[model samples]
Target: MSTTVVEVENLSFRYDKRLKENILSNISMTVDQGEWLAVIGPNGSGKSTLAQLLVGLIEADSGKIRIKNTVMDDTSKWKVRRHIGIVFQNPENQFIGTTVQDDVAFSLENLNMPYDEMKFRVDQALDLVGMSSLRHHDPSQLSGGQKQRVAIAGILALKPSILVLDEALVMLDPKSRRELLTVLQNLKRKENISILSITHDMNEAALADRIILLESGKVKNCGTSEQLFVAEPDLEPPFPELLRRELLKRNRNIPNEYMTEEEMVNWLCKSRLTV
Candidate 1:
C-alpha cells in the first residue's frame, strides 16, 4: 500500500477579514510518498497562498493539513514541519550564509544538531545536489540554478519526506532549469521524497506525475500529463508536445509518449539502427 505523505482537506483561506472572497476555497489534495505533484495556475490563482498554508507559514481560515497522517495543529505543528521542507522562488532571498557549505549547515545548526552530525549531514546534502565541488564558493559567485540547488540542499539536510517548491525555478535560465530538474528527478528516485512544485511552468508541470490546475482560487482540472495535455484538444500543450503534434501532422510517426524533443530524437535514432 502506498503511504500518503501530505494531505490537505477542505482547505480554505482569506487574507483580509473585511473582504468577502477567499484566496483559496474548498481545496483538497494528497501527495503520496515519492510522488511528484505540480500545482499550476496563472498569477493570483492562489497557488503561492496554498503553498504557504501547507507549510504553516500562514494560518488557514478553514481546513485541515496533515503531514504523515498526523493532523497539523499548534501542538504538532513543529513535528509536522519536520516532515516537510520548502524552497521559495528567490534563491538569494533564502540564503543567509556567505558560503555554500555554511548555508547548507544553517538549518541543522538551528535544530541544535551536534557538530559531528551536522558536518556529516551538510556534506551529504551538498553532495546530493552536486554542489560539493563548490562548497567553499560564495553564493554570489554561483549561477542562479546553483544557488537554487544550494537552497534545496539546505532543505535536503533535514531529510524531510515532502518538499514544497514554490516557483523555485522561475529565476533560472533554460539550461540551468533543466539541470535543476534533472537533479530533482534523481533526488525523487534515490530518496523517494514527495515533491509538490507550485509553478506556472507548463514544461515543468508536464514532467510531473500529476498536475492540479487552479483558476480563480479553485481546482479547474486535476489529471496526469497525458490526460490533460494529449486528451484535451481545446487546451494548448507544452512546447515539446506542440512540436510533436506538428511532426505528426506532417505524417512523421512519433510515439504517443514521446512528448519531449530529446525523447523523439532518441526514438528516431533507435528506429534507424533497427532498420
Candidate 2:
C-alpha cells in the first residue's frame, strides 16, 4: 500500500470576514507518495488559494491539513513547509539571485547549512534540472523555459518530499512546457517526490495519475483520467486517443487503447502498413 504524503479534511477558507462566500469550501483530498495529482478549475475557482493554503502562505478558516501525518497549525506550519516546496507560474518573479547557481543556493543559505553540504546539494539540484552548464549564467539571460527550470532547481535544493506547482507552466511555450513536464516525471520516478500540479491545461492534467475538478470553490469531480475524462466534457482525450476514435469512425480496425502520440505513431508504423 502507498503512504499518504498529504491529507486535507473538511478544509474551508474565505478571504473577507464580512463576505458570506468561501474561496474554498469543505475541500478534502489526498496525495500519495510518488503520485501525481492534478488540480484543475476555471478562473477564480480557488485553485490558487488551495495552493497557498497547502504551502502555509495563508491559513484555512476551518478544517485541517496534514503533511507526513504532522497536523498543520501555526506552530507546525514552519516544519510542514520544509517538506513541501512550491513553484509558481512566473519564473522571473521567483528568481532572487543574480545567477543560476546563486538562485539555487539562496534557500540553503537561509537554512544556514554548512558550506560543503550546501554546495553538494546545489550542484545536484542544478544537474537534476539540466542547468549545470549554465550555473554561471545570469537568470535574465536564460529563456523563459530555462528560467522556470532554474526556479524548479531552487525548489529541488530543499529536497522536499512534495512539490506544489501553482500554474508553473502557464507562462511557457509548448516545447518548453513538454521539457519541464519530462523533468518532473523524472523527479517523481527517481526521487519519489509527490506532485500536486494546479493547471488549467487539460493536456497537462491528462498526464496525471488522477484529476480533481474544482468549480465555485467546491470539488465537482475527482478520479482517474479514464473516469474523469468520460465524466467531464472539458477534458478531451490525448491526440492519440482522438485519432484512434476518428480512425474507428471511418471503419478502420485499429485497436482501441489509451496511448500517447509517440506510441500511436509507432503502433501505426509497425502494425498498419498503410500510411
Best by TM-score: 2
User: Model 2, range 174-266, lDDT digits (tens) per residue?
Assistant: 999999999999999999999999998887887889999999999999998668876775656666677777887887768765666667898
Write down the lDDT that model 1 would get. Answer: 0.88
All candidates: TM-score: 0.92, 0.93
- Each candidate: RMSD: 2.5, 1.8
Segments of candidate 1 deviating more than 4 angstroms: 231-234, 251-263, 270-275
- lDDT: worst 10-residue window of model 1: 266-275
True-vs-predicted CA distance for residue 14, candidate 2, Å: 1.6
| Index of the highest-lDDT prediction | 2
lDDT score for residue 68 of model 1 = 96
lDDT of each: 0.88, 0.91
